[model samples]
Target: MIAALYWSMNIPGQVAMREGLEAQVKIINEQAQQTNARGIKLIPRIAGDGAEGIEKQIQQMYEMVALRPDAIVIQPTDNAALAKPLRAANRAKIPVIAYDQYIDDGELAAYISSDNFQAGVMGGEYVAAHFDNQKPIRLILVEYPHVSSTVERVNGFLDALSGNQQKYQILKTYEAVEPISGQRAGERILADFPQKDSVDVVFTVNDGGGLNVVEALAKAGRNEIFVATIDGDPKSVENIRKNRLTRIDSAQFCGPLGAEAIKAAYNVLRDQPTPRYALIPTFPITRETLSLYPGWAGPIPQDFKKPWSSLEPMWRGQSRVVIP
Candidate 1:
């Protein structure tokens, strides 16, 4: 049997990201079965929310290394600490594959992630399109550190506005501990923003953050500011459906990514050399394209109904843990 370890930076429990990773795990297992290859088994490890100091995460990485699974597919907590585990895996002859997040290491093979930079550009373009022209636009950006995906996204967004800085002025940048903290930060930002309608746009790194910004703006009795974000979570999909705001998602394809990583590990097991990276291109998702896009929306099965439960904050403006 080909054994692999999977770790996500989304803490021990958060239904949305957890469900996505679980779905990815399921798909990888099924793909392994269909191929008649020794199925890849995933051993899951949690790394908190990437905010509660790095010591625990570092310890977890070492534990995962000690177990020495056939391979490890990881979304790193701290990009720097990732190198130690990955190097240990390498020394032990276990392949490492990364998805959604990248760690700086030369020996590791393969990364399957959406083009985060392009997604950011799409967000900027969406906001620009709303204005019909690039005018003096004031905006707020909420982001986090160590998640290369998020950083790449911000780079892409800024690149999209190259030579267009005059058109968009970033009023402030707030760093959140996690996506849930983003909501609280959004609420605080609302109070600080000028009462005048000067702020025209809000760009967040993910749907969780964007939705928080939306909630805060709504609470402040403010609308009309174009909100854009990454991550095609169900709430973002519902917002698109209702035309609440425009979103440029990276079409979070967790299954395909995990499956590809598993396939690569199988190749490694077979003593075959594989490529160093798998660049999954970004797929833009707007309201008109939601139906064609599958698996990006949350709350899983379409047969279920909860009357806005899909869009309602699963985190409920506060962060907590719910393990499965």
Candidate 2:
């Protein structure tokens, strides 16, 4: 019987991560069905957006690792804080695959994720080029913590703005990951940094948070500012199409990468060769290509149909999708 442990942060709040996890779970289960192996059992977990919440989640992961499953797949709540669990898994000789978040501890079997730094650079450069030499550029920054991608994206954005900071000063940075909460945070920040007829741009690390900022700006009748974000979920892509958001980088293939990580784990177990890291490209999504996505591409709640334990046989090549 083959088993796996998969951890994902609170899906109810972060749509992009939630959707990515759900899609991977779906593919993993389907693959298991074909393999006729004991299904890939996933131990589900989530961490919210605060220090206390993250601490609790890390403790839970440590406890779960004691069960000693075949592999542990995770989008860690905090890569730095979760080192203890990875170390434990390493001692137990258990293979671990981290998705979306990279663990530099060198204990994991492999890491899979999008190139968020490049996405951020593109976003920053796009905005900088668009608003060249602008005056009184009031900027609002919406940020989230814990996730490595979030931190990297912000870093890349700032890096691109190097030597071009005077024309665009950040007025305020808001916090919150959930769209509604993010919107409220944006509103509060807006009230404090109200355009003053000089605000020119708004930036968010992820699309869900960006949407909240856009909603707050719309309600306040502040449409003159350029908004940019990472993750081209349907809504954000739509915003770009409608001209509400200035740019969108769709690091949208995370789900597929997660699914592949499981396959990589299986290959490792079977003594087959596989890459230590899988890099998924993040391309910009504009109004011209927004229609290509499914209607549920945005911040929709995850509704996974099956559990990981029931999907084992599919991975052995039975009940699998046949490619042309």
Clash number by candidate, in order: 2, 17
TM-score for candidate 1: 0.78
Worst 10 residues of 1 by lDDT: 315-324
Encode model 2's per-residue lDDT on 1-324: one tens digit a residue: 123333424332244444655566667678768987544556665555557656876776676667777777766767788887788778888788777776656486777666676667656666665665545456777777667888888887777666345366777777755566577877786777675455677778876566777777777777777777877665666667777745554444545555566666666776777767665555545453454434333332232321111111111101111111
TM agreement with the true structure for every prediction? 0.78, 0.77
Please report, as a residue range, the 10-residue window in candidate 2 with the lowest summed lDDT.
311-320
> How big is the RMSD of model 2?
9.7
Residue 313, model 2, lDDT: 14
List candidate 1 segments past 4 Å from native.
Answer: 1-37, 132-134, 163-166, 194-196, 297-324
Best by lDDT: 2
The regions of model 2 sitting more than 4 angstroms off are: 1-39, 104-106, 134-136, 163-167, 245-249, 288-324
- Tell me which residue pairs clash in candidate 1: 11-48, 110-276
